[model samples]
Every structure is written in structure tokens, then in C-alpha cells.
Target: MRSQVITGGPFTGRHMLIVIVAFFAVVIGVNVTMAVLASTSWSGLVVENTYVASQEFNGKAAAMRAMASSGISGDLLLRRDVIQYDIHNRDGSPAVVDDVTLTFRRPVGDREDFALALTKTSEGHFEAKHRIEGGDWIVETVSRRDGVTVMHEARRIDTAEFGQ
Candidate 1:
């Protein structure tokens, strides 16, 4: 164990300085190379596959308007089993919803929450099933397509008690 100890020598400090310099040199070299690579034109390689990107955005916008115009009541429906929400999109439009996150907020006590994971059922529809005991809940949804939400303060509707 004692033989394994590295005793300092006259060249130790100089060697360390040399090693540090070498490390910095290598790092600078790598950065320069990366900069050159990044600046180089890969325009020839860029495939113009976005023939309908703008159209998709427009389609999403139309879908949102349609949802609002349709008689879909906005409320948080409680689920013991999985409940599916049907997303109806307008004609010549795509689903505006990029992601729909449902948060179950406890009503009475200090604010506690369980995240509901939504899976796409069809073209525009998404579903999330959560097992929860009977309690008042505030569900929060993040509609990705629309920047501002039409509704806040999620209404918790009981599955057995009420019919929508």
C-alpha cells in the first residue's frame, strides 16, 4: 500500500501544468471543430418534407373553434374506471389538441393532485382512466393547441350519480 503512494517529484508541477495545457488545447480544438461543422451548409441535406406544416396549424385552430361551437359541456368527470372523451374535429381540419393533461385536485384538504395520463383513442379523441375514492376534485387540463383555455375551475361530475 505504501509503495502505491505517488511521491511528488521535481517534474510533478511542470507535468501537471503541461497536462492542463494539453487538456485545454484539446477542448479548444474540439470546440473549433464543432463550430466549423455547425457553420457548414447542410442545406442540400435538409428535406423539405413540411408541405403541410402551415396547414396543420390552421387545421388545429379550426378544430378548437369547432369544439367551442359544439355543445360539449366543460366539466371534470370523475372516473373509477376509464372514461373516454370524444374529440370532434371540424371538416378539413386536424385535432388541435397536442397534449391533454388532466390533474385531479383534492377539493377540501390542502391542494394535492394525481396526474391523469391521456391516450389518443381515435383521430381527435383522448382518454384517461383513473382509480379514485369518492371526493370532490378539481381537474386541470392543458390544451396545447390553444394558448388560452376556454374553461378553468374543473367541475367534478360523479360517474354513477350524474348522467352527462
Candidate 2:
């Protein structure tokens, strides 16, 4: 048998260049993917003006606490065809308010948000004849009497819960 010497090729500069390019390509690809997902998923905007919201936070909190302490609460009923709300005091009597506003808002965005003024159907009961899209929503109930907010409440609801 003849003795033979077989040698493998060296790691050349081309190989180094290929490795660097591949690494950077992967990094850039992942970064772009993450950027697109983040942008489409959430706007990261909780409020239009954070400064003003912060300034009013304390007063809002106080009002909410006062409303809670007053033993007045509200219940919202929503459907695709109509919206209903009932307000009651601690003693289970109907709470009275001059005006009732229902704000329907998306949990993540405001594009589908809308406010509706409900008519008083009876004592402590309000209703509006409007069709709302069925989905996840954050509903804010604001009941006011004589231009002053008497009860304010917010709740997360799925329209499916009410057979919408």
C-alpha cells in the first residue's frame, strides 16, 4: 500500500465573513420581528396626556372612594340590541340620577369606544336602544344628577356573557 497524506482545507477569511454575516442576519431578523409585533400589539399609550391624568388622579381616586363609601352601586346589562343599567343603594332601594352615560371601550384601544346617554325607563333603571358589537369591553358607568357625578364605576365585560 502506498502512504498517502490527505489534508483538510484551512478556515479562510471567507468562512469568517460568512459566519459574521449569518450571525448579524439572525439578529436583525429577530429584531425586526419583535418590532413589528410590539407595534401591532399595543400602542403603549395609557393616556393622551400623562401629566394631566396624573394631576387629576388624586381627585378621581377620592371621588371613587366616596362613591364606594356611599353604598351606591350600579349593574350593567348589555346586549347586541340594547343596553340596560340598574342603580341601587345599600338598602336595596333604587338610586336616583338625572342622567346616565355608558361608555363602551375596548380593553386595548379606543377606536371602537363610544359613549351613550341612557334614558330613564323607571326608578333606578336606564336603557338605550343601540346595537353594540359583541366583544371584550371596558364599560364605564357614570350617573350624574344636576351636572354632578353621583356614581362612577368601570367594569370589564364580554358581550357573550349577556347573550350578545
Candidate 3:
């Protein structure tokens, strides 16, 4: 009997080359997609200079502590097309100030970030009409009286929490 040689099976050179190419193609494609998404999502800078920001952290914290010591507090309520902010004094009374600015920022993107000057509706209730989409948002409220910032509050809110 003559010796038999088997060739050109599933393990052929062509098949191996195709498999390797496909594996590398998939990896490169996924990496490219992730890079594009990360680039478009966030700029990755909270402040212009990290060192400067870090230096200012202590001052900011002290300011916040001073504000808290004064017993000034704020509450934020969100609706579909409106945002309501209520400020209170240490005595549980409505704290009305001269100007209240609300800054709305998206957690992931800054494109939709905006600032709204809330109008005084009632004693301590300030409101502004805004069309907020369903997502995570950081709401910053700054209350100024006589050109001095008296109260500063920041809170994170999710539209899904209100079933929006």
C-alpha cells in the first residue's frame, strides 16, 4: 500500500490567514470605535489648569463652610420644562436674595450646558422655564445679595428619578 498524504483541509494556509486577518480586523475596529466615542463624549478637563484648581480647592471649601455656617440652604425641584429653587435661612424662613443664577451642566457633555437666571416667583421660590432632556445633570445654584455671593449649592439630578 502507498503512503497517503492529506492536504487542503480546514487548517489550510488560506484559512489560517483569513482567521488571523479577521481577528485583527475585529480588534482594530473595536479600538477605533472606542477612541472615536471617547473623543466625542468628554473633553476631560474640569478646569483650565489642574494645579490652579487644586490650589483653589481649599478656598472654595472654606467659602462653602462659611455659607453653611450662616444656615443658608437651598432645594431644587425639577419638572418637565421647569426648574424650581427654594432657599431658606437658618430660622427656616424663606431666604430671598437679589440674584439667583442656575447653571445646568450635563455629566458627560458640555454642549447642552446652560445658565438660567431664575425669577423670583414667591417669597423664596425662584423658578425658570427650561427644556431639559432625560439624562444626568449637575445643577448649581448661586444666590447673590447686593453683589455678594451668599449661598452656593450644587446637586446632581437624574431625570429618570422623576419618571421623565
lDDT, candidate 1, 48-139, per-residue tens: 45666665778767766765675333334444576555443445343545556677766544335577757866555677766665545556
Task: State TM-scores per candidate.
Answer: 0.41, 0.77, 0.89
**Cα-based RMSD of candidate 3:** 3.3
Q: List the residue pairs that clash in candidate 1.
A: none
lDDT of 2 at 9: 83
Pick by TM-score: 2 or 3, better one = 3
Candidate 1 lDDT score at position 59: 79
Regions more than 4 Å wrong, model 1: 1-79, 89-95, 146-153, 159-164
lDDT of 2 by residue, 29-139 (tens): 999999998788677888899999999999999989999999998888876787889999999999988889998989876678899999999999999999989789998
Task: List lDDT for all candidates, in order.
Answer: 0.57, 0.90, 0.90
With a 3 Å backbone cut-off (N, CA, C), the pairs that clash in candidate 3 are none
Q: Mind sharing the TM-score for model 2?
A: 0.77
Ranking by TM-score: 3, 2, 1
